[model samples]
Target: MLTVILYHVIFVIVVYTDTGPPYNAFPQKLNFYYFSLYVIPSTTCFFIVLLSTIFLVVKVRRNQRWRKGTSTQTAKTNDKEDKLVRTIIAISTIFIICSFPTVSIFITQIIHKQFRYRDPYLGTLLLLMFNIGGVFQAISSSVNIFFYYRMSSRFKKVFASLFACRRSGIQGTKPSD
Candidate 1:
């Protein structure tokens, strides 16, 4: 991952040299490379998360059936596992929902070379879509914390403790009278 990130940094530095207003006006080949760089990994991640979530759900259901007659301890473990699986599914679903717009826009732009240039109305619509996709991307990246805090009691405790420590440090105790 670090290597990939470094490569992308280098590539962006090399390709995006013009410090001008029309930043989107890259050459065709560079544009293709940039789109591919974003689209491939995002699409791959989406599919992998989707497939793994499905696999986990199926496995959990099968295991639940097998462990129906197990002891309370085992049932408790299964409950924890079920909560984990549900959290994962929720996260994955959010990812898919959030990423769909960006992915679709990239694919559309790739296939339709004149997507943002063909018609004035169409170009404006595409620009709107692009902005909306950016919003979704931001939401997707940052919303995981909310899910963890809401779904996991352990996460809530740790999160609250972190803030509690900060607040206590900021407000030191008064001296005894």
Candidate 2:
């Protein structure tokens, strides 16, 4: 319920927020693709992940304190929940770290009323930073697969079995075998 309301608020903000004119990619002309696809989605994911992690961590800790006298099963359940929270934290941290540069650029553009790309060197630097940020975003996404494999035995087993089946299917079907 809270999440739905939060998303609606975010949607309103995303629809109303205007991009600044400083950056070459995102001008004040208001491109729908930029707002709808890139900006809104990026901002929404960042906020949702961040807020969810904070709320979930708080709830989990509160529950732990309240259930201090519970049995071992409750303790195990708390341990599992703690692990899940940690994973969420790790993922959100990586996402924020990767997307920091891009967000910074956007913020800078918003703050500066005039275009900041008059100097060629500054423009080049911003372009490079944007590209580096994109690379980092890709790395962050790819690393989540490794995290899943590391943290979840089920995921690891399924991934391994899928690959093993492919390998066997390729090697086991030789006519000379």
Q: Compared with the true structure, what per-residue lDDT tens digits does model 2 show for residues 20-134?
A: 3343545444445344545565666767777887888898888777677564446577778777777777877888888877777666655753424445556777677779989
| Over 4 Å off, model 2 | 1-37, 70-75, 115-121, 175-177
What TM-score should be assigned to candidate 2? 0.71
Q: Residue 106 CA error for candidate 1 (Å)? A: 1.7
Instruction: Indicate which candidate wins on lDDT.
Output: 1
Root-mean-square deviation of every model: 3.7, 6.6
Cα-based lDDT for every prediction: 0.79, 0.71
| Model 1 Cα lDDT, one tens digit per residue, 104-152 | 8877977987776446767888889979989998998899999999899
Off by over 4 Å in 1: 1-4, 17-26, 69-73, 117-121, 173-177
